[model samples]
Target: MGVRALMNDLTGSKSDKSECWMSLRAPELFRVMEKIDKEYALVRKDAQKYIEKIDFNKRMLEVVLAEATVAYQEVYKAGPLYARIPGGLPLGGPCMMKLPDTVLFFHRMKLRNDTFLRVNVLHNDMVNMVLRAHLSVYGLHLKGAYDHTTTGQVRGTLVHTPTAGELGIFLEDIKYTIEGRYRFMGDRLVIELIVSTLSIRNMALKYPNATDSDPPVRLLKKNMADFRTGLKTDLDKWVQDYFNGYLIVADLQDIPSLWKLREYDQYKTSKLAAFTDLAVARINKRILDIGGDYIRVPKFKIVAAYGLVINIYDGALRGLDTMYRRSVATTVFKRDNLRYVDAIIGFKDLEVSYRYVVNFPPGPLMPPSLTGVLRMSAKDLTAHLSLGLLMDPEVVELDINFINPPGPDDITIEGAANILMSNFKHILRYEIATIMSNSLMYGVGLLRTLPRCEPFVPGMLRNTTKLGKFNKKKTLSTSSKNSDEARSKESNYTRPQRRHGTTVKMMQDIGTK
Candidate 1:
């Protein structure tokens, strides 16, 4: 009677149209349609929120990327590449000879050129004694009066020059050079040097039993080459002994604003959290194979492939000096002072293997990745020309486990519980990848700033201050001025004394008259 009857009167077909109107009025049908409408609206709202969330995450990532780029540039600008080795030979520098016999020399020497290291052997009594004892068979005399010229070169007359045969050996000049790679063995830093070149001159044999059969030029060449080869062998041995059993310490500074990012407004913090979650998820999914060890990121591949192993035991976070005393494990933190975030990390033994490729195949070779070509071998010329490089794929294996801390500045039981609840491994992996990638890039920039060649300067071997002589002269002048003033004052007082004595003499004469 209600809407159904009205629809029937209008259409003039009561049966068909009436049933349609009646179906529309049913409660069950009305409920189903309403439920579908409500669900559709809710889904539409959720879809809009999801799109916005994605856009927000993208913006947050962009900000982090920009900051990382700037930090990288700044690290490079700060000059990390320069070698921190002493610029010149310091006084009392330690030196030791390794080849024929182990002998320690007291005198320090400085590098003059790549092939020349200037040393004062004759003046150093200990060095001279050792050389005379060892080099007597070669007719070389270390005991001789020598003059240090204004140019800092040692010039002297040979003591055995007259006694030696017509073609005697003369030590024309002694120099040294460093010619090996700087590398790491276990936890030690090592470097070796070898006598790659030598300079010698021939002299007439003056002794009675001098052999005339051997040509002077040929004899000199043979003797000098032998001496150099022997010296190089000794030097290699000395370097190994010196650096053996030594530990290298790596000090890394704390990040100042790492934890502050969490204290932002609700919207901003939420966006950052989403971004971090996604980043962690992506890293965990990769499961990269580095050398033999599986790691979360590929950047660590360089360390494994290149024998650069980070020994955590040798490194300490300087800011947490007090924390280390409490517990070695507790030294690593999740957050500190509401401003710093720490990623707990553990390292396994690092393995690096290298192979040089001298020859290339007939067909074209595949291009290498960024981590693959970090170091190129100069020995492979064919590989360089044909395939753009010459080295076997370096195998690096480093096993690492990252542990997440509970909260900001929390290192107690509650924090540990929190870490267990939140997927700690995933969070730690993300944090480590972020920190290490930036560190590696920064290190490369630093290496680029090192000087290509040793700097050559006369007084570089010693701490020769320019103002030393001037300061001495100034002191002498001031002392002389004070003495002159005292002398003038004494002369004036002596004249007055004589005048007073003359008056006394006149008074005595008047009394006698």
Candidate 2:
């Protein structure tokens, strides 16, 4: 044979192996590999008897995603600061960033453009499609089309400037329907949804019975008695259909992040996230030993009488908070070399210089949130108008607060507020991108706008000068002195004001709100 032919023959099948004698594993070893696969087959019932490991299946999880809308709602509270609703927001642009004027203005211009698609865009689309599908399955017809088509999108503000008393009472322009979205990669359904928000308003659609001249939404709201007893049958059936189809369409390997987060939270934050990563890494090393690219992977399936489904829709975007927290911890660890050997283990000996430190709550201090909120429009085309507000919210803040202090892992309201603002960096950047993407969404020309805000400088300086008198005294003490004459600064227009209050830092807002 030629040199090339000889080389091929040498590296070929178990033939001319006089120079090489590689031993093969026995049949028993194959059984072991097969057994290794079987571990993933059985449920973890009676795990303590056979597995003898601390939550063995728990080691199989790495990351989790939560219901973004619900997560957002949990942190949402009425911001007290006077916010300037930019002209663009009222004119169909998304200015969901709710904050005081100075901060709100800056972020509205920033989050105008972004790459991370808002979860709501996916949600609205999904809800529209699935609801239509449900109606089709039920053979229901709409009396009229959405308002955006029949009547132009109301050019004026849908809501008025609300007072402090109207804090919890929002004039809901939309109504009840489970608005959420899910992505299917083959058979897995990676879904995100808001099961419930803390809000208690009925924002569901009312079907119209009148003629075209007076096109009010047709409301098929379930009888309040029926609703209180249980969801109406049609609604319940539709719910099952939506979730079942949502999950079944995706193959078993495409489970979503929202479900994972719920499951993880149920387990009380089991250390599963860490163990699964290490185990998967170990399995990969085994494949590397055999000079193969293929590695052992997870085979968790949601089997039922209908069929066996396995899904693996694992995305970190679902766990925005947990991921952010981890990111922060990682940065700190990397900066500090991740060693605690030399540091004090407890705060027993810790002494503070400040006297009488008091803690306040988190929500009222939060900057407006400006991330993840997408377009919500009541534009129904097929003779069924959207029965709710089509709000394009621009969030300016999300405050993270403690529910209960489990030892020293608690955060103050001020700390949580800072964290929320820090994470909202993406929101700011995306707003700017939105402007660049759409031509009609242009901002005030920089040349013309720059000179306009300059005059407010003198006013900002005056506020600073006034802060000195209030500094050495309590808020009530100074306010009472000028009770009648003083023009109390607007709470919403907190911009250009120096920080005040000693107890302001301790607000711990747990958003069961």
Candidate 3:
């Protein structure tokens, strides 16, 4: 009441006091407050947009998973039997070793068998979807930060982290192709899958700014280099493991050289043998359980052989032209010391191949002789070749032809043939294992490298305003409490004032009373 009365008395009216209060507020402050409100509205709008984008990406991921599921079902229909005997052999049969009349014949048969074409189609589609999703997330992050810079908006600090579009540059214009070939050799069905041209150099070149010397760029480059190295190493290891797995067949073990190779178990070779043993056992058990009368063979003799050959064409070597000659002069080639030279140098292409073979006994519809099997008419042989063999030929030979005939100086045809004959089995095993391992790791790596989409919430982007409101409330409450405490202390310290002559009178009155 005291302050209000004093203000009214001085100003002459309550309306005058209100006018004074309004005059005291600066116009600039009101304008600044208005600008802040507008900025906040913009921030909210941006956050809403980001949320919508995330929801769209989530839907895309669901679609991708659905497609992948359908593809997996097709592949699953064949069962583990297809993986074990990739060459699409009948239920019970001896292994087909010789090269068929044409590679096309086996390829067509594989399509007709339980091995589904839809599997490959699904894989390709899934990969593309994953890649697109990763890019979309990354692009959003970049745009959000860049928008803040242009509009003078203060997004949360975490959003400002520069992504620089590294993943986009790596994946752009890159294609994933899977080529499969099926061949029958010895007691194994050779299934070969070639995944062609996975590299980032071309994409990197396209977007030079993305690979600038920034910290994020440097880190990404280092990670990619390490991944590439790991892939090559893992590919080699896979080749070894897969080869050992297929070599578990009883007939193959009879080779003296193979027996000696098996003794090198310093690197947990026992684990490889155990894995193959378990796999083979499971396949046999499944056959017996399902194909009771259909399978008349004493036992299912089948081998799944896989091979991976990564042919790396070196651009640097191409430029040097004479580097191969120089290396040959300086380096001594040892037969036992098999090492990959292409890995040390960058490769332009990678070739992968896998093979599976199944062996079954002669059946009512199938003959025991190869000649008899091949001699049957088209209609009769169709059923036999499709399900069983009409004839079992005693002698089947593999004819080798060179695409580009080698000169005598480089390597005689006879010498090349001899070398191939000596190392064919070993090479086949190594390639198969490497390809399988590489494919497995490659899929895992692709998934791992996908960028995560951060959830878009209002708090994430508009944190500054929320924090400001909290701080303002805390400041107002603390100031108000301090002012009340100060007033009380002041009142306690000051004595009550008496009238001009009341000091002496007050004492006299108190005495009289």
Q: lDDT per prediction?
A: 0.21, 0.20, 0.21
- Candidate 1 per-residue lDDT over residues 1-513, each given as its tens digit: 467664443333434221111111112222332343354444334433543445532332233223324453454455321111122322111111111111111122232112222221111011000110011112231211111101011111001111211112233443333222222233322332111222234322122244566543223232221133323334334423332212133111121221221121122323323322322222222111001111111121111111222111111111100101110010001121111111122112211111111111233452222111112111111000000100111111111111111121211112222323242232222222222222222221111111111111222112223223322322322333233234334323211111112111221221111
Give the residue spans of candidate 3 off by over 4 A. 1-201, 204-223, 233-244, 256-513
The 10 consecutive residues of candidate 1 with the worst lDDT sum are 381-390
Reference-based lDDT, residue 78, model 2 = 27
lDDT value, residue 268 of candidate 1 = 30
Global fold similarity of model 3 (TM-score): 0.15
- Model 3: lowest-lDDT 10 consecutive positions: 380-389
Compose the digit string of candidate 2's lDDT tens values, residues 219-243.
2222111111111222323333434
TM-scores for all predictions: 0.16, 0.16, 0.15
Error of 2 at 353 (Å): 14
